[model samples]
Target: MVLPPPSHSRPSGALARRAVLLGTAAWCVGATGCSGGAKSPAAGIAPAASAPRTPSAASSSASASPSAPGTPSASGPAASAGPGGALPRARPWQPGPGEIQPEVKVAAVRLVEALGTWSRGQGTDRAAADRAAALGIPEALAAQLAVRAGSLRPHADAAVVRVIDAQYGGILSDTASVLVVCDQPTLAGAAVRPGGTTVDVRLSRTSDGWEVTALHPAAPGPAEALGPMAREVLAQSRIELPPASVADIRSGAVHDSVLRAMLQLAGSHRMSISVVRSGHPLDVFGTDHPSDHPLGRAFDVWRIDGHAVVDPASSRTLISAFMRAAAAAGSYNVGGPIQLTGGATANQFFSDDTHHDHVHVGFTA
Candidate 1:
């Protein structure tokens, strides 16, 4: 089943613009609030869990394995000479003209930015709610967001969030799901720690636009001994994943075919995965055909060898090579930004706007 085209552009500075809009705009009104089918932001809330730690420099060598699942890595930015050393500021995310349902994705991204970011001396208790309310989100939703934000332990006086990718988990006429992948660098007195999370954001459609309804933060699933192959993939320094995807791997739901292919592809390039099984559409975006992702037989990679697949500046050669490699690793269906010819089958390789930002690899087995 074919979905829409990939339509994200490089982000620009828009924090000031957002602040102004948030000050004047209003999305919540009347007794109806935003939408009827909206799920409560507090429902199905997962425990606040930290992402799998980035491997330290010493363990990140091409030949070395990644640090264990929860191992702590180095801190974030070095403090500046000023009071708290200027902490990084998140540039508000905006969708490009080609994005599918741009407003929906924007609503999801903005909500996450509000929940994860804060200024110096701001108490975590109310900071998320206050920022969300300023963005025109309803009071009830903002308060729920505050409760979710309270579970986080930033260990810093200030924090900033940088969204790496925002992808549609599912999109329908009345509701939608967005997977918001981000990196947060926090600033303490002078010490900064690198942190981030992936959230499954739920939204419902309204005349104004899409209104955020719920937030599902990823949780590190209960510890269980994993197969050798699965354990190795989790420890591989070259393979990166969001917290939710990490949990998927740990949950023992992913098929072996997917894990093997990931290891096979990692042999050549460093990759960043955006979604696995847990935070994806059960069916293909627009069709009833079941998506390989929900079956644990597929995965999406957004960054290859450190180059974002969406960026026009990333080399075509690299992305193309990665796609081909997926086929070589036993993927029956391979989709990416570039449409390559000479695959084993006529439809083996595909290029579409919806897949413009990442490479999708699906296995039948």
Candidate 2:
């Protein structure tokens, strides 16, 4: 559309001046009533400031004018709205014990937002058990463990094993990982109390899902190391690291090739070690477990490279040979049934559906 030239337009100053003059005249009316009989409409015209103003859509929707005797403005008494546009006259939300605030979703806690949001929930049926098995928090298992432990106090929902530090033991491909232990409050009003309660929790990742195979107290052996391992895995996997540092589960000090070496040396025949399911304590026992095992030096042996080794089925060649090597090395103690059935190893060991699929080995300095 064609527009008029800039020179033809009147300046804004003219309008502003008129508005000011009208305001001054309104003020003079209050100071002095007209000596003449009746006042003219133009004489008492309201000031621009006093006139009703159009409210912006972004601001309040109501328009405002001078207040009359005892009436409220058109904005209507300010009130808050509920789910719908209708205002809620009463009964606003009041937070109660164990009540999760609407605003405090997984995102609300900044530091643990990822842990809370991204962690896949264990199936509902097994949520408590799954949480226990997953090394969640003490209070988590406490709720259930309390049932078994025979107590009724609320306890920590999960225990956190955080990375305390990382130290490279200097190039023989050795590095030390440190971890700080804490607790996660899943259940409200739960406390771990002093001296701490124990639960066994296994950490396993499958192609389809991540599973905690076991949950129990910190045992004396390899399982004690699981907390450290869990912490390292949780941190290193999430952060950038040095090139020499290894990211694979096996590379870590926890799951070195010692297990393979132990099994291979014991078996006389060609033996392969395949992981049936690899996780922490949960894979080994329930949360009420009495003792912790393989904290730093234990592992469960499953198949010998896809070959079943449990039940009536016995592995020949490999079992005997692996035991001989272990006996020769004399670095640590080796137990289990590689020597039994004409094989050259000890059969003094424990077995279960958890360890049935594979053999678990632990390391000790």
Candidate 3:
């Protein structure tokens, strides 16, 4: 069974420099980055019939279950204003090849396009501003964003969520709507702001193209960012993988990919993996390690062709060669066999001798 790591083990700390603004740049599938894997060894979660609901409720659910469960919050920044009450509607950009993320690519492009349009309409007509509110805009958020626009400072980076809602009945001719939700900072000069508004966007299909009809802050805010991550993982059958390692044999995204390629290079090698708990290295668990194994960002590969590849001291050298091949192919943080008890090389990081019979390639994010 795959027992998730302690929830407290991972928390979103202040994001790193590159992680900020670079968007999906850090979303690569390697060990030395954010580690994640599938829940069950076979496949991950089933797809929901409908997308999850919006925030307000999501926050409550997350707080109730502190366990590392539920979907990722789809929260992110929307358009902001400049010093003189103007929104920062920057143009959207496209993703490059080999970018592992699909949703991030789509959402980022959409958000940028939405904001850029907003920027062009400053003053000429609050038409863009009005459309912003109509599209489920947050009211109090306007003021908060105004502050961010006036004097932007570097505090902890926040997030932006994208929400899509279908509106029928009551409104004009019944239609479907999509809105980008932005949560502005709550504090200003050491004081609390109340009653933030959620922005709503009304889109219309016109002769020119789809255009924003109105923008308004709805009562309930937009949904969190979790669902999108959940959706992505569900489709891919993988979880986010981080980067951390053991000895010479490291296993993360790059390493795992390398191992697969190495197997291919070595003429059709079949593989099996077991998730033995602590002190049970030689023991095998499941049949196949899912492509996106959730055993942290790292993985342990043993029992090639039903035999163990033990002896960390001597085996480390051979594994080192494997690591080189894997690294050249873009693997990261690939470590080798865990040193257990018995010989001079035993029990270095591991406590028992079971691993003496198999190889542990722990990949990083």
Residue-by-residue lDDT tens digits, candidate 1, 147-190: 75422324567766656577665555655567676666667677
lDDT of 2: 0.22
Segments of candidate 2 deviating more than 4 angstroms = 1-214, 217-295, 328-331, 338-364
Of candidate 1, the 10-residue stretch with the lowest lDDT total is: 28-37
Instruction: For candidate 3, write residues 201-289 as lDDT tens digits.
Output: 22332233233322222221122233332233212311111111110112111233433443432332222222211101111111122
Q: Report the poorest 10 consecutive residues by lDDT, candidate 3.
A: 29-38
- State the local distance difference test value for candidate 1: 0.59
Q: Identify the superior model by TM-score, candidate 1 or candidate 3.
A: 1
TM-score of each: 0.65, 0.26, 0.20
State the RMSD for candidate 1: 9.5
Looking at model 3, residue 73 earns an lDDT score of 26
lDDT of 2 by residue, 99-160 (tens): 11111111111111112111112213244333332333234432343222110111323222
* Full ranking by lDDT: 1, 3, 2
Q: Candidates ranked by TM-score, best first?
A: 1, 2, 3
Which segments of candidate 3 are over 4 A away from where they belong? 1-175, 179-182, 191-197, 220-365
Output the TM-score of candidate 2: 0.26
